[model samples]
Structures are given as structure tokens and as C-alpha cells.
Target chain A: MKKVMLLIILIMMAIVFTACGGENESSSASENEVSIWVHTSDETPEGEAMQSTIDRFNEENEGTYSAKIEFIPRSGAGGGYEDKINAALTTDTLPDVITLDGPNTAAYAEAGMIAPIGDYITNKDDLLPSIIQQGTYDDQLYAVGYSESGVGIFYNKQMLEDAGIDLSTLPTVDQPWDWNQFMELSETLVNTYDTAAIDMAFDDKSEWLMYAFSPFLWSQGGNLVSEDGSTAEGHFNDENSVKAFSFIQEMVKEGYTTITPVEKGFHTGEYPMKFGGSWTIAEMEDYPDVEYGVMPYPTSPDTNELVSPSGSWQYAMASSSEKQEAAGALIDFMTSTESLTEVTLANSVLPAAHSVVEEVQDKVSPQMNVLIQQNQKSAHARPVLPNYPQVSRVFQQAVSDAAYYEENSDVQELLDDKTGQMEKALK
Target chain B: MNTNKRETLAAYSFLAPALILLGTFLVIPALMAIYYAFTDYYLLTPDQRQFVGLQNFIEIFKDPIFIQSLKNIVLFVAFVIPIQVGAALGLALLINKPRKGNIFFKVAYFSPVVLSLVVISVLWLYLLNPSEGLINSLLANIGIEAQPFLSSPKQAMLTIVFVSAWQGAGYQMLIFLAGLQNIPSTVYEAGKIDGVNKWQNFFYITLPLLKPTSVLIMITTLISAFKLIIQPMVMTQGGPMNSTMTPVYYIYQSGFSDRMIGYSSAMTVIFGIIIGIVTLLQSRLTKEDDI
Candidate 1:
């Protein structure tokens, strides 16, 4: 009994000592330390480039400030990194700087979790308009996206050829095909293959629904919310939005796309075309047998305006940080033209700045260059709202419910029903 | 101190670690959940929380998605309890007597219980895929058309029920096996002396003796069935028109993904009450059976 009690006491003492040791170590580094939390594993090329950028920043700012980076990888359903950030918001243990998704700028800024770093950026004019638009909330730049992302129609060259489609007549960023023409091509492919013509990642059933499919709504002259980001009722359920929803529903109804696509159908050559983003470039490297090419988004038949989704992870200064200047410096350094080019080239992502685009234009693959071109010409960022997640979820469910193609499945009614849900979130 | 007091102190000291862990991880969080249910606590703006009495609870009851989730969970629990418990008892009976290569059958039946639920869900997702899955190919060979297992809202909840039961019945089977072993052989011997056949012996003796174990399994399985989240989260993501959305999954989505902590807490509290009532009802009925 005595020995057991002594053992317990020793264990307790050891735990106390370890806890104190950890606090002492952190405090020692707290004087000039600028901690950063990123949303990727360290082993990835993007994470390595981020670390090198931080190391360079630390070297230049040596005795004045030191920056430390922590990588918190997100899971498939967008949990780990965001979960840590949410927990830290309550506990007040957030790092000096943290990485957040682009659409979250409004939420974070409105909640006072992130500070505006617009004045910190040295070359703000050099950043792409879409990146600036994505990072800005209420006319203040709360976050700066390091890399831009854009979705495009990825088509299998062989399948298109087999379906008797002309290669030279395909859409380009400058002169994109209209939705009617795109559907005609989808019809041909479906008739030839006797299967779903495209994989729009409908099976993902998450943010991808809004991210990849919202372009259609935008091209049709519909907005998820008003320009003021105040309401989603008339805009989300308006005629233009209904046209976009029905267009999506038509594809599923006509057997041009499916709600449940085969996993990696495009990569495996099971589907002729895929609605894919810039990240799909890296993913396509594994599929050596399939030769693919990128095409700009199909414009709406009525408006003929091209639009594509744009948003990626961005860096922001945490509101809890006392050393705001140092945090701002780190954010500035990481999003500098050179750092952006390095990160973009390493991750195979679209460039966030014009200078980085010029630097990586010749180096990146032609497929990626096509996406970059579309991004510059036609990218539209998602709606920036404090309750963007709920709004996006409602939009996602609307897409899913509409695409199921049952009797009495009124697209307008579905949109109106979903609009009510979005309105609740917006409120 | 007296010897008795010292012993009691030592016993408490031994339990200190587990008690502290439970208090920190479970008890405090539960208490916090109850308190947060009455407030408007958004996840991002935690410090800006406000106490709005019964607002969250009232709002959740009105929310169509929450009501749909409640309906789905109840349907799941209603189907899963009997299917899972029946399969467990069937397996327990199959392995009760020693047979050739019995260990292999036991291991095979118990293997899925040890595997992670996420892995099982993913594997089943591929197997249940409408077109390219192995199950479809096998069905094709048998001249049965491919079924849209997870894609059809009408079929998704039932499909999940089967997958969950297949994955969960092994552990319950082990418990039933123990209960079977605890049944005295002398009782069976006396039944044999009374000229009772095997069927009569099982129906009259084995079943009557297994009531306590069956009741225990039913209560546990009932509680777990109410907490179905992982399978839907991994498989369908509460989709195909929210056909498989369980209450727990909706609560997680509300709190973590949608960042509506107050609403989610209200949901958790309501779900807890429902479970408590159902469990009480089950136990009351079982007690009457004993009487």
C-alpha cells in the first residue's frame, strides 16, 4: 500500500514537472516568437515551401523576430485544421497567424478572430483581383490567399475523339462554349459511351457542390447573396438561379451526369469529361493511359458570361496575438511574389499574383496553364458571409435533391425551399 | 489514521486517475452541453454568447432537418435492434458446441468487430456501389439488376442497417456465448430425464435462462443504435435527400461544421432525454417479464 501510494505521488510529481517544463519552454520563446498554424502536413511540397519561406523570413528578421510553423492537416470532411482553430478560439490559445479557407475571411473577420492585414502587404496591387476579392470582407483585407484555385472541364481526348467531337472547336478562356453547346457534346459522349458523360464529383456531397457548380449560377447572372452580403432570398431563388439548377438537373435527367459517379471515373476513362479544379492536375499524373485536356467553363446560354470558382487556403493574423506587426511581417513575407511562385510551383496550384503567374507560366504544365488562364479571365469567389458554411450546405443539398430527378421534383420549389434555409443561416 | 480509513484512502488514490479523466473528458463536457443548450453560442464567436431561454430547443424542434434526422434515427434503431440481436444469438448458438475448426469460425465472426468502423464503412461503400462494385458484378452474374444501394433514399437507411448489424453483432455474440456457458448442464440433464427433446429443452430451459443476458444486450444495443454517426458520415454523408441522417451526425454537423453550438447542444440534450426514456421503458417492461 505504501509503495503504491509513493508510486502515485511520483507519477503526479512527474506530470507536474513536465507541464511546467512545457510552459517554461514556450515562455522562453515567447519574446519575439511568431507562431503560425498551416492546414497541411509538413511532408507535402507546399508545406516544405511554406517552411522555407518562414525560414528565410526568420533569417532576415533574426534577432528582431522568429517565426515557428505548425502543420495541422485537414481530414477529408474538413475537420482537423478547422476543428483546432474552433477549439483555440474558445481557449484563446490560437497562434500568431493561422491559415483559413478563402470563404472563411468574412466569418473570421466578423467574429474578430482575425485582424485586417491590408496595410501590411507591400505589393497589394500585384495580387490578382479575385484573390483580393476573396480575402476582403467589408472593404478590409482580412486574409491574403497564397495560392488561387479554379475549376475547369477536364475532358479525355480519346473519349472525345471517339465520340466524334472536334478538338479544335473546343472552348477557350477567351471564347468559351455556351451551355447548350456543352450539353450537345455531353449528349454525343453519352450516346457513344452509353454511360454518364461527366463526373462532376456529385458523389462528394460536400463543399464541392457549391464550389464546382456555383459557376453555372454566376454565368447565368445569379448571385448566391446580394452584393451587400445581406440576403440570399431573391438572388438564390431567382430565375437565373433556377435556370442554373435546372441545367444541372437536366444533365442528371438526360443521363449526361450522375449523382453517384464512379470513383475516379474520369481518371479511369469511364467518364469522358470531369468538372475538376487545378488540384486535379497533380492527380492526373497517376493516370498515364488517359490523355486529357482542360477547357474553360461553359457560359450560360442567356448571358454568355463565363464564370468559374476561385478560392484556396489563405493566411491571416490571429486577433489574440500581441505581436501583430511580427505576424503581419510573416504573412507579408509568405505571400510575397517569390514565395507565392515557389508555393504555387511546388503545389501545382494556380498563382495568386500576376507576377507569380508570369514567373511560372513557362514552367507549369500546359493543362495547368489553361486553368490559370481561365482563373485570370473568369474566376468568381464564393459569397463571403459569417455563416457561409450553412449557406453552402443548403446550396449543396439543393443540388443533390434537384439532381435526383424524381417526379414532382420542382427545381424552383427546391431552390425556394433551400433559399429559406440559406436565409435562416444568413440571418 | 485508522487502518480502515487508510485503506479507503488508498483505494480512492487507485481510482483517482480514471475518475479525473472521466470528470475532465465526460462529466464536465456533459454539464457544459446542458448549460449551452439554453444559450446562443456560435462556435467562432464563443465570447459573444448569450443566454436565450428555450430558444435553441424551440428552434430545433421547428427545424425540418432536425426533425428528419430524428425520424431517420428512430427508424434505424427500430430495425437494427432486432436484426443485430437476432444475428448475434444465431451465431452464439452456432458456436456454443465444440466442432471441427470452431476457432476459425469464431475468429472470422469476430474479426470485423476489431476493425475500425471507418474502414468497414469505406469497404462496404465500394461493395455497395451501384455500377462498378463487386456486389453488383455478382448480382449481374446471378441475373439480378444492379441496385442503387446508397444512392436511393428509399434503400439507403436499410442498407446502412444491414452494414451496421454485420459489423456490430460479433461483440454481442461473445456476450451471449458467455451467458450460454453459464447455463448449468445439470438443468439440461434433468430435462433429458424428463424425456424432453432438444427443441423442447432449448425453448423451455436455455431461453428462460438467457433472459437476463438478452435484456442486457438489448439495452446496450439500443443505446448504440441511437448513436449512429460514423457509418453515415463515411458512407453517404447524410445524403440522398437526408435519408440516412442520424441525430448524432446532425448534431456534429451543426456544432462542428455549421458552427451552431447552441443548436447542437439542444439537440444533444433532447436526444439524451429520448434515449433515457426509451431505456427506462425497456427496463420496466423487462422487469415485468421477470415478475
Candidate 2:
């Protein structure tokens, strides 16, 4: 019996060893073949559009060059997909063409994980300024986006009308609502509607905080980091930055905005207004009964300056890729005016290319035109620094603290704490 | 001599596969973590890591977030172990008989254990929502004001502890049930003959017999409590104001989100040492109880 058991165990060990030793043979791509890794799966319209683009690229090149895509799921722990990309970088297994969040471009470029595509991209000047700003690192173009994203105030039209607020009198991009008027409107709407005035999506304690609210800081003439990008002390803790955050703290304190709101507060009519992204346009279509309109971010009460958050996912070439030329070709084809129009239409996003925006101007809804105009005029890319991930996190936490403050809670102190954290991280 | 050698070889063959797996997955990575903890290894620039000696460890003590995380986890362990172990014991005692509905009770008690922690956390997040969640809605129905169970900084950690204890008690209950069954019915009958009442029998006989089982449950629950990450990460994101930031979640944030692999590794090393010391102390106490 002992001999039989020992023999069985030995056979099991052999099988295990064999299984462990089996190497995954890399699919032998021809010299002309280039592989891409995209975050979106083929289930969505955007993913399908991307796939169709790749298929068209392959068909056009025929035997000259081919592009294939491997879909990577972006959902998981906060940085799960980025972690996968980082692992691939370490193992020298990164795909030739890679799509990454625009804000990550600086970090990837600094780490030498992505190569600059300025020499390959001819239509750099045609791309929207915000897109160009987001994709550039050290004054070099490292990535290019096909579509841009912007956030604006989405107000319930019926609720606003019921509150006796005239739609025509509302702020426009050229003459946006000053911070004081915006707060007064929010207060009036809350009393009239008997619901939360605005949904700033405090529950989404991630990149959303920095993306949607940083415009307030910028419009107030404050910046996340200095021009040198070496320090955040004077810049993040500046008078304007403190004032900008104070507005948010006051809103939360007075119950104008909720620190913990239902996920779809505007769609469900739980709130009169929402500081929502362009993606909300698609979501609003689901609720046709609830009429809504988009307005530019409210201007700073002190400066009357208008700024809107901008930047979205962009494609780049991996530094380790041997087929850089072919990868660059894939990126160029994807971000072309024609491709941008198709993708922007399919995804219901603002087109990155200036020509695409102009060509599709009359075709899209009036609400979309608002986003397009903002993307062109008022959009400001998030701080394009290598330490952006850290900067965004510290700022997000500080904002959360201020928003969830109780009595005696200090907004300036929170901001100063974040400033210190950012300084330490930059070291 | 040849026969003995052959027997030893056969035993060694039987152990090879498990040993190899352990060495590859757990032992090697643990050693690597120790080595990396002494470096400045950023996840993005893995090859550019340089030795920083005790700098990372020294910094960890000074990091307010890390200190807060340490305090939070210690509090979590302190509250969760007793509550969970007690709940498990209560449930085990209630269902350790041959009653008609005992099987049903066992399944009901253990259901939460089978559910994934993420699913449980998400479900509780919805149930605990202050405005429109099921719990608050029910509270409103009862003419009671809604409680901000998760949103309040004061209540968030305690709420998480209660939810974690509720979810985890069932697994430990099964172990306690086994310990209960091992105590012979004859022992109880003997106590009954001596005119000992039910409560007296339980206090004198059942309580002493359960010491080993209690120690085992305490050690396991303590270890698991110290590793609390998923609940806070999914439910709170360690906020209202970093009130629920456990050591493990902080380690995860440092390693993955912040990409500070070396600093995170140092934290993991410290956390591992703490867990090790706790386990050793628990075993030693249990052994002394046996003596």
C-alpha cells in the first residue's frame, strides 16, 4: 500500500512539474504584424468602433502591416489594469500599440514605458488644444486621443422652470454663471424642489473629484503644481486654491451638495443639478421624460474666469516595441479626422480633431455642441506631471475631508495637509 | 539499511509537490519582499530601485496615514475577535443538538460565509445608504430617524466591525460545533445525577471543555481581523476621514495605487511580524491552558 501511494504521489509530482514547465509560446507575429492592448471590451459601441477601425487598418494594409487588439478589462481594484500594464513593462511583453488614460502619459513617458509619437503624428496641430496638452510630456507628444471629454453642469430643465429660473437668463460659455449666482441658484432650487440642489458625486472618491472640480481651482487662478512641476507648496496652497475649495466646503456644509449621494442623482430627479461629465449625455437619453440642459462650469466669483475639465483616454506606442513605425501608423490612423468622427459619434463624445468637430457640428444634438465648444475654448487638461497619480490622490482625499467636514473642520488646513503630502511624495 | 532508505525516499517523494508549490509561491515571494523592503522600488521604474536601508521603515513611523492605519487595525482586531468568537459560540451552542430544524439553522447561519466578501460589502453598502437604503428606509418606517451608518466618521469603523463579525461568525461556529460534539453526553448525564442544573453544567463542564476551541477561534479570527481590507475598500474607500483605513488596505494603496512598492513591502513586513507575534502568543497561551 505504501509503495502504491508513493508511486501515485510521484506520478502527481511529475504531472505538476510538466504543467508548471509548459511555457506559453508567444504567437509568432509576422514582421508586419502589430498587436495592440485596449482597455475596452468588444461589447460596447466604443469597443466595437475601435475593433472596426483596426479591421479597416488591417484591410487597408493587407500584407504590408496588420494590427490586432487584445481587450483588457479596466474594472477591478483601482489600478488593476495599470498594474497589468506595469507588469507587462517589466517583463518586456507590452503590446506595440497601447491605449492609456491621458493623465498617465507623463508617468509612462518618464518611466520610459511609452515613446513619443510627435515625429509620426502629422495632424498634431489639428487636434484640440486640450488633447494636445494632455498627451504631451516635457514638450514632446507622447500620445494622441481620438475623442475628448468635458464636464459641465447638467440641470433639470423642468425643475429649473418650476423654480422660476428662466432658461435664457442662465449662464453661457462666453458669460458663465459667477460663483455667487451659482450658489444662490442652487439654494433657490433646493428650497423650490425640496431635494438636494446638486450632485457633485462625492461618493465616487476616485479620479472623478480631481477631474470634475479642478476647473473651479483653475478658474480661480490657482494651479495644482508650479510651472517647474518640482513643488506643490505655493501653488496648491495658494490663496485662490484655498478659496476654491472653501466654496465646495461651504456647499457641503449648507446641504446644497451631498457628500453621499445616490449614484444617478440627476437621472432619478433626486437633484436639480449635477456637475456631470459628457458621458451623462448617453445616460440622460435613458430618461427622456426628465428634460436636461448642459451649461459651462461656473466662473470664479473673484476672477470671472471660465475653465472646464478636459482629457480622456489616448493611444501611445510602447517603448519596448520593435515595430514602432507600424505602431505609430496604427495610432495615426486611429486619431485621423475620419476615424475621430466615427469614434466620437459612436461613443457620444467630443471629437478631438478640429475638422471632425466642425464637420459633425450640425449632426449632433445642441447639448453636444455645448461640450464641443467647451472642449475647444474653456477646457484645461489636468496637470501633465509625472507625479499626477499621487497629486490627484492627495487632492481627492483633501477635498473629501473638506466636503465631509463637521463643525470646527478647517478647509485650509486640509489643503495644507495635502500640500505637505504632495511635497513628500515628490521627493 | 536498504529497506529503510527506500522507505525514507518514498516519504520524500510524497512531499515534493506540496513543498515545491509552497517554496515557489509563498516562501520565495516573502523573501523577495524582505529584500525589496530595503530598497526604493517604485512599481513604474522597477529596475531603477536603489537600497535605502532603514529609511522606509523610519518614514513609516512618521507617516500619519500609516500610523492611523495601524491604530484602526488594532481597534478592528480588538473589537472583531471577541464579538465574532462570542457570536460563533452562541450559534454553535444553539444548533449543536439533534433537533428537527437544526440542519436548516446551520445552513442559515453559514450562508454569509459562502457569499463573497465583495458581494457582502456591496450589499451592505446599499443597505446602509443613509438616504434611500433598505436599513434607513426601514428605520423611517418605524418612526425613527435615519442613521448615517457609514457616512459618519464616528460610526463607520464600528459599523464595518459589526458587519464583518456578522459575516464571519458562521465559519467559526462550525469549529465550535465540532468541539461541542466531542464532549460526551455521559459527562452531562453525570452532572445531572449530581443534581447540577443546566446552567451549572454548562458553566462548570461545557465552559472548561471549550477552552481549546475558543483559543483556536480567537487566534484565527484575530489573524483574519488584522487583514481587513475588502470591506473598507469597497464600502468606504477608507474615508469619511480615513477612519476605516486598515493596515492591509493601506499596504494595497501604497503598492498598487500609489506604486510605492518598497514602502508597501516594508509595511507588509511589519504587518507580518505583528501577525506572527500574535499567533505565537496565542499558541503559547493555549499550551499553558493545557498544562
Candidate 3:
């Protein structure tokens, strides 16, 4: 009986050991296979464009390399695709090329999960400056964005006209209205409508807070971090940042916006305006009653400098993969002018490269044209920091806290406290 | 070759598969987590990890968000256990007597339990929306103002508590129902012979007899409450101001979102210790009652 028990234990141990040891030993044993992972399902237009791009790459490279694509769509809470990537990181089973969000460029590069691909990119200058900015970390380009994104103030044309405001007198992307002008317009709309003036999506207590609202800080000559992305103390807590924060607080205090806005409030014309991105254009099609037009971001009163947020999923090479040249060629092909045009048009997203910008200019809608112009002129990528996730969370909290700002809610103090938290994340 | 040896061999053979699975999946990962708790094991840079001793532990204590998460979870468990267990008891008692449509009532009560938590949470999110939700519209019909149930930090945890109880109590009610059924009718007949009234019979007989079932339900509810994540994740993303953040949710965020696996592991260890102490106290008290 004792011998039998010992034998059973040994067999179990052998099974466990063999199971653990069964991981593939050679990543590049099949040298021609170039695996690519994207963060959208194949059913989506963006995924279809990605598949076509890979098909083109494979056809062009033919026998030397065979590019394959896998779509892993992200969940609503932003997990599925990233969860797979994180798991793959530990198992050494990461694909040759992977799609990452733009802000993660610094973190992935710093952790050595992705390799620098500056030497691999063929048309570096043709890419939009914001795309380059979003993909660079510590002076090295680690990734290349395949598309760009833009946020603008989307308004109900009927509501503004009913409020006796002339549409043409409104600020254009070339010369946008300042914060004061925006607020005045909001107050008029609110009084006329007897409801909240705009939906800032304060209810979306996620990365949207940081992504959509950070440009407000930038427009005020304030930044979440310093130029080199080293620190957040003076920059995040500066007077300019406080001014931008107070502007948001005032909007909340005056009932121009609500922390808990009705779902699709702007879509249903419950609000006169919304601080929405280019994606809202497609969603607006569902509501034909609300005639809407895109407007540039309301600039800070001090600088009157226009700055809008820009970022999207970008392609990066996985460090674990030995097929660096093949992966690089695929990435270059995916971000090429023709590929970019196809993707931007198919997905109805902004063009990442200047050449594609011209290719897509006349093809997209007039509202999209406004966003494209904004992207070309004033789009700013978020700070490229290795601790961007933590920092962004703190920034999001600051915006949330300020939105509930009362008389006791000193904007400076709130920013100062948040800056401390940002400092901790930076360390 | 005796009977004793043969029986022992049979028992060992039956237990082998389960033991191997437990060791491979649960025990190994738990051991790995404890080991990583002492290191700076960033998820993306696993190979570059370095031993950092109690640094991660110390940092977690210093983190205000971590402290707030701990407080939120404790509060959630404190409220959810009693409310959920009590609701289950009430429901069990209501359905204990056999009557018309008993099966229909049972299924209706158990329906939420069978549905996915994510679906329930999303449904509740829309229903509790401040302005456009059905709940607020109902409130408005009575001339009451719309409430920011999930968006307000002051009310978010309590709102989650009620929601959790609504979704979870049904399963516990089924357990209580079985426990109720196990109580023989003769005991109630004896109570009736002693001239006890309806409320009196319930208090003197049903209450004391249901002790074991109630204890089991309370313990399970307590533990599940401490593991709160999905509701907050789906509904609020752990904030209008991190009011609904729980320790488990924060641990997940640190490990996956921030890639600070070591810090998350440290939090897990600490959370496990806290749970261990609570369960130990509970068992000790329950044992005393048994004695």
C-alpha cells in the first residue's frame, strides 16, 4: 500500500512537471510566421481594415513572411485585450506585433515589453506630429499610431439658434472661442432651455475624464507633467491648471453640466451641447431630430491657445518575438499612407499621417472635416509616462473632485492634493 | 493484505485526483503569490523583478486609496451580511408553508440568482440613472427629487449594498428553505400543544432551529461581500470619487491595470489575514454556542 501511494504521488508530480515544461521552447522555430494581435473584433470595420492590411502585407511579402492577425476586442471596462497581453507577457507567448493604446507607449517601452522601432519606420515625417508624440518615449519611437482621434464641442444647432445666437458668429477651428465665451453661451442656452447646457460625460468616471479633459489643462498652458515627463508637482498644481479646474467647477456650480447627466442626453437633445469626440458623429446618426455641428475646443482665456486630445490604438513590436524585421515591415505596411487612408475611411477615424490627411480630407463628412482640421492644427497627445495609468487615475480623481466643487472646494488645494498623488505614482 | 489496508488504498485512490488538482491550481498559485509579495514583480517586467522585502506592504498601508478601499469593503460586508441573510430568512419563512403556486414563487425568487451579476448590475445602472432611469421617474411621480445613487460618494456604498442584497439573497433563501423543510412538522405540533401563538412559535422554535443555516449563510455572505468588484467595476468603475472601491477591486487594479503585481500580492496576503482572523472569531463564537 505504501509503495502504491508513493507511485501515485510520483505520477502526479510527473504530470504537473510535464504540463509546466510543455511551453514552446523556440519562438521563431517557424521563422516565416508573423503573428499580429489587434484590440477589435474582426466583425468591426476597423478590424476588417486591419485584416485587409495584413492580407496586403502577406501578399507583398509572399514567401519570405506570412502575417497572421488575431482580433481580441476589449471589454466595456477595458480588460479583455489588455488582460490577454498581460498574461502573454509572463508566458513569453506574445505575438510578433501587438496593438497598444497610445498612452501606454512609455510604459510598454520602459518595461521592455516593446522594442524601439524608429529605424523601422519608412516615412517618419509624414506621420502627424501628435502621432509621433504619442508613440515616443525618452527620445526613442517605440510604436506608430495607425489612426488619430479628435475631441470637439458638439452642439445642437437648433437650440443655439433658438437661443438667438448666430451660428456663423461662433468660433471656427482656426479662431476658437475662449473659455469665457463658451460659458456665456452655455448660460444663455441653459436659461433658454431651463436645463443643463452640455453633457461633459462626467458620469463616465473612467479614462474619458483624463483623455477628454486633459486638453483643457494644456490649453491653459498647464500640463499633467513636465516636458520630459519626469514630474508632476509644479505643472499639475500650477496657477494655469487651477484656472482650468475652476472653469470646470464653475460649470458644475452654475448647473451648466451635471455629474450624473442623463444617458445620451445630448443625443436626445436633453442638452444643447456636449464635449464629444469624433466617435460621437456616428452615434449622432441614430438621432436625426437633433441637428448638430462640431466646434473646436474652447480655449483657455489666458493663452487662447487651442489644444485638443489625440490618440488611438498603435502598432508596436513585441520584444519576445525574434522576427523583428518581419514585424517591423508589417507595422510599416499597416501605417502606410494607403493603409492609413483605408482604415481612417473604413473606421471613420482621423488620419494619422499628413499624406493620408490629404487623401481623406474630401471623402469624410463636413463635421469630420472640422475635427481633421483641429487634429492637424492643435491636437496634443497625453504625457508619455511609464506610470501613465496611475497618473491618469489621479488626474481623473482631480477632475471628479473639482466637478463637485463648492465654496469650500479650493481648486488649488484639490490640485495640490492630486499633484501629491501624481508624485507618488511617478516614483 | 488485510481489510484495513485495502480500504485505506481505496480512500487514497478516490482522493488523488482532487488533491493533484488543488495542488496544481490553488496551492501553487497561492505559494507563488506569497513569494512575489516580497518582490517588486511588475507584470510586464517579470524577469527584472528584485527582492524588496516588506517595501510593498509598507507602501500599501501608506496609500490613501488602499486604505479607503479597505474601509469600503469592511462597510460593505458589515451591511450586506445582515441584510442579505435576514432577507433570505424572511423569504424562506414566507415560502416554507406549502401552498398554491409554491414552485412559481420559488422560481421567481431564485431567478436573479441564476442570472449573471454583470447583467443585473447593468440593468440596475439604467434603472437607477438620476434623471432618465425608471426609479427616478417613479420617484418624480411622487414629487420626490431624483437621487444620484451611484454618482454621489455619500450614497454609492449604501446603494451598492441594497443592490448586492437584492441579487444575492435568493440563493441563500433556497438554502434556508431546505433547512426549513428539514425541521419536522412534529416540532411545530408540539409548540401548538404547548399553547404557543404563531409569532411565539416562530420565535421559540423556528428561530433557534434555524441557527446553523443562518450561520452558514452569514459566513458565506460575509466572504462574498469582501470580494466585491464586479458591481463597482460595471456600474461605477469604482468611483464618482472611489466611494465604491473595494480591496479586491483595488488589488485587481494594482496587479492588472497598473501592472504592480507585487503590491497587489501584498494586498492579497493582508486581505487573507484579515479574513482569517474574522473567520476564526466566527468559528470560536459558533463553537461556544454549540457547547
Better of 1 and 3 by lDDT: 1
Worst 10 residues of 1 chain B by lDDT: B282-291
DockQ of each: 0.66, 0.53, 0.65
The lowest-lDDT stretch of 10 consecutive residues in candidate 1 chain A is: A403-412
- lDDT per residue, candidate 3, B87-122, as tens digits? 988999899888999889989989999999999999
Ranking by DockQ: 1, 3, 2
**lDDT (CA) per prediction:** 0.92, 0.88, 0.90
Better of 1 and 2 by DockQ: 1
Put down candidate 1 lDDT per residue, B1-291, tens digits, no spaces. 699999999999999999999999999999999999999999988888999999998888899988999999989998999999999999999999999988999999999999999999999999998888998999999999999999999999999999999999999999999999999999999998999998998899999999999999999999999999999999999988999999999999999877889999999999999999999999999999692
**How high a TM-score does candidate 2 get?**
0.93
Better of 2 and 3 by lDDT: 3
lDDT of model 1 at position B216: 98
Model 2, runs deviating above 4 Å: A1-29, A76-80, B97-100, B141-144
DockQ of 2: 0.53
Residue-by-residue lDDT tens digits, candidate 1, A1-427? 9999999999999999999999999877767889999999999999999999998998999888899999999986567889898988889999999999987899899999999999899989999888988999999999999999999999999999977988999989999999899999999998899999889888998888889899999999998889997888899999999999999999899999987789998999899999888778889989888999999989999989989889998999998999999999889999999899999999989999999989999998889999999998888888888889898999889888888879426888888888898888888
* Residue-level lDDT tens digits of model 2 in A1-427: 9999999999999998777666322334367689999888789888989999999999998978899898886885325567679889788899998889988888889989999999999798899888889999998999997788998889999989999999999888888888889999988988887767999888988888888889999999999888878899998888988999898888888778988788787898889998876678888889989989989888898899889989889999999899999999999999988888888888888889889989888988888899888778888999888777788888888788888767327767777878999998777
Q: Fraction of true contacts kept, per model? A: 0.77, 0.55, 0.94
Residues B1-291 of candidate 2 have per-residue lDDT tens digits of: 999999999998999999999999999999999999999998888889999999999999899999999899888888888899889999999998678989999999999999999999999998999888999999899999989898888899999999999999999999999999998889999998999988998899998888888888888888889999999989999987899998999998888877889999999999899899989988887788582
TM-score for each of the candidates: 0.94, 0.93, 0.94
